[model samples]
Target chain A: MDKDKFFSNDPRFKVAKKEAWIGVGLVLFNFVWWFAFAYGLGSKSPDEYTYILGFPSWFFYSCIGSLIVMSILVIVVVKYFFKDVPFEEEVQDIQNQSDKKSS
Target chain B: MQEYFLGSRSMGGFILAMTMMATYGSASSFIGGPGIAYSTGLGWVLLSMAQLPAGYFVLMVLGKKFAIVSRRYEAITLNDFLKSRYESQWVGILAAISIIIFLFSSIAAQWVGGARLLESLFNITYPIALTIFAFSVMIYVIIGGFRAVALTDTILGSIMFFGTLILLVAVIIAGGGVTNIMEKLIAIDPGLVMPFGADGNLSASYVSSYWILVGVGVVGLPQIAVRAMSHKNSKSMHHAIIISTVFVGIIMLGMHLIGVFARAINPSIAVADSVMPTITMEVLPPFLAGIVLAAPMAAIMSTVNALLIMVSSAVVKDIYLSYFNPQAPDQKVRSISYLVTAILGVIVYLMALSPPDFLIWLNLFSFGGLEAAFIWPVVLGLYWKRGNKYGAISSMIVGVTSYILFHQFYPNAFGMHTVVLPILLSLVTFVIISIVTEKKELLQAVHK
Candidate 1:
């Protein structure tokens, strides 16, 4: 019951760790994009505001625009980068056996 | 016990996504959120959209390792995961206590919102409405358990999505289109059209910090994180990440937009929580409004059901079985589960009877507390091998205490949410303590 080896030695852990970082990166990206448009374009007085498709430009870009873009980006990341790992208990047993054979 | 608590961990992508969305998009988003948006204007919408990445962050962060490890540990609840990860009885006890206390407030918020929605929708008295909502939710939860919740959440989640889209369009049309609504909102208050609030109360820092409360920090919500362990496989988990992100983004954006636009049509509504129902009844025909209003009901019901199940499991399985009656028979455990769920519903119902002015604040307060308490222990415990019971126990204690003290004395300290400071302190505590104890454990191992 080597707990450290049990987690770290599994191939799934490495992939999951990598994906979690990407997940965090995506969240940060969402915040930065949201902040830039929300605060950057929105900092001006409301009198100087412009409209796009009936939405005020700042609200349009910041909330609606980010929603569309983040949705697409999340789908792309999951489709391309994320892998399908088996959840069955036996998969770990198989993984252990394979590891023994390789070593 | 497995089937009762976790639906035998057999949920697929759609059910997983729906259950997660339905659970996360609770009375706050459906009612309290929109109510605030009704007054605060489009800036509040932008602020609420901080929740756009909630499902994505939770599933992605806790996806694979959480599922595999929980399965390995035979864990059913979040406390179960904590108990095994730290291998400390105190960690499990502390987690159960936290879940019961914080989740009670949140469940009460949902109850208040649900009763209010019913009161507004049916023109019924608040007490009757509260009773109706409580009875229906309890009956199904006590009888059907987790599978019923997941299955119903799928239907309810769809209702919420389409309901929001319909209400948004209806509100727009009733207000003479998007351009006209914008013009009217501007004429009322120029700030209404800006990224700041109608009163310019929503500052940039406060809004950005919400990303932690509703976005990334969502990984720490036990109700949501528990879903990460229940998905059938990694492929479905991937599908769920995409599906839930899309659903949450649209529902949040649409509901908030309806709230803002409702201001243009009916600027005189008094209570913020009533804005959603009032506007729906105003804009749509009676039949259509009835259907649209059910969306919030669905949201509240599903959320309450999920929380009820979790709390009952925490009390019955985590506390009772582990400590009081380890050899309790299946029949007794089942009866105790039903009894706990019913009693919890009654207590929350009583709490909701005194209804707060803004249930959203209550909801978000609980969110901050839960996130502050569990974020480090759960996340660090999953990743860092060195993290142990001391780090977890210290982090939970520090995080929960500092969060409460900050929330009490100085909410939104430094223009950031009160949750920000405690989460930072807890992270530091977890790392330093884990490192210090790693050496101690190493010494003990060598002596052995």
Candidate 2:
């Protein structure tokens, strides 16, 4: 079905293509976020005794701070970006299908 | 509960959030993980954050599709989804076998963790502790079923939240300050303060692989994925995701940090798993210790209850009814479920009799097994229409076999965790086999 969608203009196909991309984008964001926090900020040791918010500078940003930041970030993305995806189909599609069945 | 496995599927946002959080935050999250952090230093704390995106992945990848499709088929267990999608009895059985084997190992580990927590808190022998926990969990699950389990998660989730918060504050005060603790850590070993971990052992490859182990691969865990199919609507799903994410974030960071700080208070703690209890007792009075102790006890009990229910449902709903007696009376099904739950509890209790001095391996094995076996099937089966029974069955067999082989012979292959290789191999198997068999399925359809 997706193979022919390239040449098709159905609105449902467009929603699906967009939805798939959104899913991929969300996954990629999570991957990069974890790598940067766990390996990037944490890759170095500075002054051997540097402290931030009672955590080692790297630990504070990467582990503790990142957790709090991610909590808010996920909530925001889910609220504003990710659409409500009902798998069965749109409510209108269901009503139309039921009418066809009865007819 | 209208459905034995999924409850009424009318869960509110709060109950949905609590059940997801409680199930995801297992005994290892409370006890074994922190114990590892106590020795591994601040690096493990950062590594633990890899789990922050766990609930995110389950809700996102499986999301609305799983719930709606499961409803369309009236499926209950995770294996029920497999049976319906692939149209194969083999797929269902293989899924059931994987859940029982891996989750049983997981259950035994949790029982050990619960018993250990009790031994430390109440000063009792190990077997006595095990008996008390086993009966308490079995009785609760037997009496209330899934609704009782979800409601208990609400109470347990609160205990986890305030419990960790209180312990974190007390630990910080006892260590003088976070700054003071950092200095004390550096004094003991300069490596302890670094991101690379104590002795610079947490390699870049090692830490990055955790992204698969705890982050994305969590979508494969049946216990967590089943929660995706139980919400009342999209709004409830959305709310559950946000709330569970916040709860997981706070507990993982706070508890692991307390593990690291335990070093500052008592530098010579003998066993790492004992770090949480020792520090909680050292920092707070006995009464508060009891309260905070409930955090881990609740963590373990809630996790065990969820696992017991899942394994029982797998045996009863997925295997027995699907194969032997599809038309079995409801009363028979009810009796069988109760009997299976009790038998499973007894088996796990016996396994935990002489707990391993270190239990990370048993728990990790279970995690890896489930991921290697189920991750590709669940994810690809849902999205890729071409995926077939050959693909599903082959993926399961190849996955569990390679996982065990790699685990026994070649762990941390090329400095990466053993699970990475099996998940990759199984995925390659799934896609290639699926494409190969796609033509046959299409041909049969055209002939008809």
Candidate 3:
């Protein structure tokens, strides 16, 4: 296969490259937001208490935040990020061979 | 002749074993082990039990498909597999960068954990300890690659397993058995021995969220995910599953329980992290202590080595080879791989010197970051038909951004981990975009 054929010619490659740019955006945003939170809010004071079922409020918040983020991630992955694209004829042929072997 | 560069014969069984051992080992078994025991009393042992199934779960869940897909694509790294399967450079690069960033922090934390372990064991300075630990790991990683790592990991895993058993027995014997220790812990502050943590600090939400971080979300982790890709075949996969689960479970339970039990043996201990080292030294003879202490070192080194290899591969294979020097020869790639791996290790060593107060949190922080970054990209990229470039990009952007924002400002915003929000936001972004920009041709190809 030619160089371009390996990457540029492949539709999947085109889409993946585009997605990577998006990932870059995400990382950039994360960096900015995290720095702001850390600097703006300062470190959490251990002496203070945020209660949830008799636990500190910070701990409770962390748990809730984790759940919300993960739920959203799952939905996005299942619904959008995981879309199927048509396989090239050559690639399909390879898949067929592999399937035959597995069976 | 295409001499299989990815899986070379140079990587024999011993090296492969070591690599596996090293990859699976982490600071959790060292600093967190004793820390948990020191605070929770004996109940930490029960908590450790949860880890036993970890290895088994990964192997079983991802089993056949993982190995087959990786092999078919000639994927040496987790990012490579994702790139091929999704046919997306963005997925590959995102996976690579995320691995680099998160593993950098994770590796640094391991270095710190190793240095701390050394400092506590010997009267050495933290920097010196850090240097020695970092150099040792970097050398083996650069020279041996995956094979060496696997071999070392097997040895380390064995040490961890037996070491936990030996220490557990010794602590029990010294503390006057389980019943006596429980009584002492109850007297000290009944909460210490409870399922929650010392001071009744561990909340239901926090503990459950741990399932995502250490449990299910583990699927997204490159260090672990790569394992799913490396096995020889289905039978090997099955064997690894059984072996890994039992081993992880025993070690996790044993180490954590030992952590909690140490409190009964040494209630006056101030720094929680020091509990394990102190208890081991106190319980066992000096010679035995020396031997047992190797277990933690083994754990730290193994984890460090794995992270080093992984991050290095992310840089060399996914980013460098795929993007910068796509036409570079094999020899050039090999040289770059070795050089980059060493450089990365050194940088992490520097980062590790200062060390964190709660080392477990540092490790978990990296874990959370990686999961948020890669979970949707890898999983949805595999199963979804509508997953488009727009959707994948949006999901990643949302997942990572929200994760960072929550982690910073409203960490545990809703009593959940920071990762939860970002993952959800990214998912919504992924679906909406894919549906809106649904391309008939792309959808048909991906669906078939």
Candidate 4:
């Protein structure tokens, strides 16, 4: 087995790396928004808390609010940015190229 | 054997999403998480939501390249991927051993959860319930195979989603309203309404560290990672990412909220794991109650099914087929696979006989260990061209050992979960070792 030919010899790996970065960004956004709201407003005493939709202001913004935001962002990003690549073997092309050279 | 293990990798978006959800949302999320929420209050609910983006992380990180690479390698299992990528027999064997050890405990915990659910629902004895649950699972796994599990997951995932919603609405109504529930919870304990647990046990550092345990590091789980290869195309992968995130959000948020709200309704409930089912019976009609109760049962069954298939494949495909019987015929492999699945089911059933008081810890323990061991190897193997077998083997060895040591002796070291330190250590070890070994190999090539 040729070690150098193991990875897909095309832009597919690049596409995956880009998508992975976007995923990291989305997750970071989720954490930052959730942490700020959950800790900022939620640090107060219950009596000191204001309620929204019968939830503590922080809880609403942090859990439910962040969830809705994440869903929309995920849909938009995956729709616009993510590529639809073939799931089959890309290394086959590399093998063919090497075989032609050898022949 | 390929179809038996991976359904020939022909799954579409919807089945892919549902199967991943059903497999990931185990008894821990359904039974143990809510139980903790019932005791810890709203903070635990927030903590559990850290798992909301789990599907997003797995699919997005391992989405396209993982599929292409595995197919190129002709890999059917996670260990096969590791073995091919790292080009080391030891790497494959170590991965298989890790899966068997960690997943064994997880499967036993799920069995215990299934039996306990039955005992509470039907007034059946524990042993009888355990026997019934084990047989049903073993029979389907032996006969229906991976396709059956995937198809059944569509139904089970739906039950979990709608059941959580229905039971949540009922609980809110039974408590009079959200405001009423909040007030009651406040009256019982004001801390219940805050971001921290009722006892302030949920610190910011601790809760945030769960992002690794259940969130980002979930990409390392073999049971979940293998699903990345099964989708028909990257289009389905995209669809699955969004669909799974939404499903996970609803189930995790709704179930934990119901757990917290149960405290408002019945403040004196003794056992915490019973909170979900107990509240369902209290609030909904008997018929509706039965339907809603299926949510946790769905969670338990689907999870056990996935784990059983994974462990079975580790034995038959990764170890047996690779090492002992590489030239074994398809007919021989098929029979051996079924026999192995049944035998593993019996072993887990025996383990479940002595039930643990709280099974979530066992599940979490397994999660942390698997994540630490596999995260660096899998992630780096995909992106970093320089990583070699030396790096992979050392990373896994160091990851598992340090995780156990930290979990045993210095838990919550630096106010983070036990997993954080091991992950960091393994990453460093992988990089340094891989760089050193790659240089040595280059020097050898020059000399030759």
In the range B174-269, model 2's lDDT, one tens digit per residue, is 999988988898888777777788878788788778878887888899998888888887778788878887888898888888888888888888
Q: Please, what is the TM-score per model? A: 0.97, 0.92, 0.77, 0.96
Task: Give all candidate RMSDs, comma-separated.
Answer: 2.2, 3.9, 10.9, 3.6
Which portions of model 4 miss their true places by more than 4 Å?
A: A6-9, A89-103
Write the residue-wise lDDT of candidate 3 on B1-448 in tens digits. 0122234323332333334445655776677656866866433443443343344444434444454445556667777776765567887777787888888888887887888888889978888878888788777777777666666677787888788789988988998976677667767876664445666555545544555566656767888877666555333443454455445555665677678778878888777677788889999999989888898888888788778878878888788888998999888988888889878876876777677777877887888888787777666665465566667766766777777788888987577667677767777888788777777656788999
Among the numbered candidates, top DockQ falls to 1
What is the RMSD, in Å, between candidate 4 and the native fold over all Cα?
A: 3.6
- Pairwise TM-score winner, candidates 2 and 3: 2
Model 3, residue A84: distance off in Å is: 28
- Candidate 3 residues A1-103, lDDT tens each? 2212333444444444444344334323322332332222322333333345432343223322222332343234324543233232345654576589799
Q: Which 10 residues in a row give candidate 2 chain B its minimum summed lDDT?
A: B1-10
After the best TM-score superposition of candidate 1, give how far the Cα of residue B88 lies from its true spot, in angstroms: 1.2
Q: What is the interface RMSD of each candidate, in Å?
A: 1.4, 4.5, 11.9, 1.2
TM-score of chain A of 2: 0.52
In candidate 4, list every pair of residues with a backbone clash. Answer: none
lDDT digits (tens) for residues B1-448 of candidate 4: 7787787787888889999999999998888888999988999989988998796989998878898888887788899899888888999999999999899989998998888888778888889999999998888778877888889999999999999999999999999999999999999998898877999878999999999999999999999998888998877888899999999998999999999999999998787667777888999999999999999999998889889999999998889988999999999988898888888988888889987878888898899999988999999999888889999999999999999999999999998899999999999999999999999999999999
User: How do the candidates score on chain B by TM-score?
Assistant: 0.98, 0.97, 0.91, 0.98
